[model samples]
Target: MTEIELNGSSAGLSGLTAVPWKNGSLNEALACYFCPQKTLQADRPKLGKVFTARNLSRIAGIEIRWTTNLADHLRLVDDDQVVFIFHCASFLQLQKSLDKSPFPDSFLQETLDTLALLFPSSDNETTNWLKSLTKIDPRLARCGSLRTRERRLENFNYWHDQLVILKQAFDESSPRNISQWWFDRRNGVQWYTFWIAILVFVVTIFFGIVQSIEGALQVYLSYKSIQSG
Candidate 1:
């Protein structure tokens, strides 16, 4: 087994405490590689009979802590562990990076080559693990940094408050309430007809008023002509 740390803090390793993962170092490395944080735990559901050695199952019981920072990173302290210290950033940005450099591409392939050199293994099993890890780089990017998650949460709350106010306004019984009601296809036709009827009524009333004013003006003109005669 190999110990791989990517852009991980080497300085923090000095003050670390130890944890048990079987009696073997190889097992310990496997445990760290598939640590139980959300990203690591996410890998487990996909693993099958083809991906790992029979002995790998023994280390599966180990618990890997997930962290967004140093405290979470320091929690795993087994020898020969492969630790990937991911820098949390916007999921959107991470996704963009992934899209620009997809898995097994030239840049990613070169990156994996360096990782393979760090971990040195000839077993085809190692390829499976690298493939899985490769899948993870992009996924972690998609999961995003903690800040983006918080902003999404804040946005949800703001929209929720606005919706609540809209609902309250909608529920109150008044002529205005009719405008707030949601329209379905069946009701939309009726709503359109109602508006058309109202528009026609307004036009008719305006025409009637204009006709009445015209008649009154004519009568006044006739009376003025009689007075002049």
Candidate 2:
């Protein structure tokens, strides 16, 4: 606070003026870019299969909000000429930046809306001025579509890698590899049931033959007794 030497009898503040208030955010014009409106809270589902409908959104660098800053120059526009200058400059900057950045379509759309809200038309003359100058830039308009294609490619590659890993795991776990895995050098048991399994296999065959022979003998005896009677 700075106290000025004001003559007494003044009811207000006794001639003391507080310093200008400051905030944590950037300029109000750039507020939308720095701070987005609160999104509805929900559980973001993790990717499910190697391929899914939503993989693009998960894998691609999709920005639900503007996650990066604009060039410093756009912030330097004069207050009186803010609408006239920013309208053209922002679109051009966005187009150039899109070639290098992975900013999603939603980010661009919201940015435009924020700027519109910031500089609303006051009269018919200003409204017409805005239309002629803020005519949509072709390149900026295509950012959303380009981002969509890029996202799909990114998402597909993610699934392709997952599929490869899954295949390797499946092959390792397959029945043919089971006994080998169990008796691997890493196993502390250092014992294998390969021969024991073969012995049990032979014993099972012997039991089957014995059961077949006994069934035949009983059937033959029953036939002989019936014929004699």
Candidate 3:
């Protein structure tokens, strides 16, 4: 009987590598994209928004456009914030699956709680984190954890689509955010309404003062006439 060895080619190099993100990072930047997988798996975040905060950016050589729609500007602000967060925070730089077990439940809960406090802000951080953790290939959408071909393929396709959305949102534009809420020039109505409000305020104040002065003058005149009589 011949004993066959299975565990082969091993580059034996080991040391205590300093961990980058120590779980309290993403929230430190005050912005991030919540991972869909983490959210689904941990059930920590209950929000559906894209970003955790709004950011203004003026990167070198990037032309920032002014958007008339306040809502759209805010949507892009979310993107800017996410990108800024990614650059500033050490959240996603952690070693993927280097542990024997999945991410700690406590860590996941902490992340979820942090994100819960930052709901309604859409971001691409989580999206990027998921792609990295899964080690997804652009050419191959795959979940390394899954075993069944059906589940693996589905996850791969799903992640690929998510990556597309994440890229689109992140790569849409440069920072320089502009919001025209009540001051949109394109809407003549808003302009007219603004002036009309000012006019109304002035007129109301003017009439009120005039009425008081007139009443005082009338009373003075009556007293003077009585004294003269």
lDDT of 1: 0.34
Residues 1-229 of candidate 3 have per-residue lDDT tens digits of 0011124422222111111233455333122222233212312112223222221122211223322111121122333333211120122213233353233433333332322222212234433533454322221111112222322212322122332333344334332322322323334675578668878999999999999999999999999999999
- The TM-score of predicted model 3 comes to 0.24
| Ranking of models by lDDT | 1, 2, 3
lDDT of 2: 0.33
Off by over 4 Å in 2: 1-70, 73-85, 89-101, 121-123, 131-229
Candidate 1's residue-wise lDDT over 118-204, tens digit each?
Answer: 223444444444356532333332231222222221222212232222222222222323332222122457567777888899999
* Candidate 1 global Cα RMSD: 21.3
TM-score of 2: 0.20
- Model 1: CA > 4 A from native: 1-186
The models' CA-based lDDT, in order, is 0.34, 0.33, 0.32
1 or 3, which is superior by lDDT?
1
TM-score of 1: 0.24
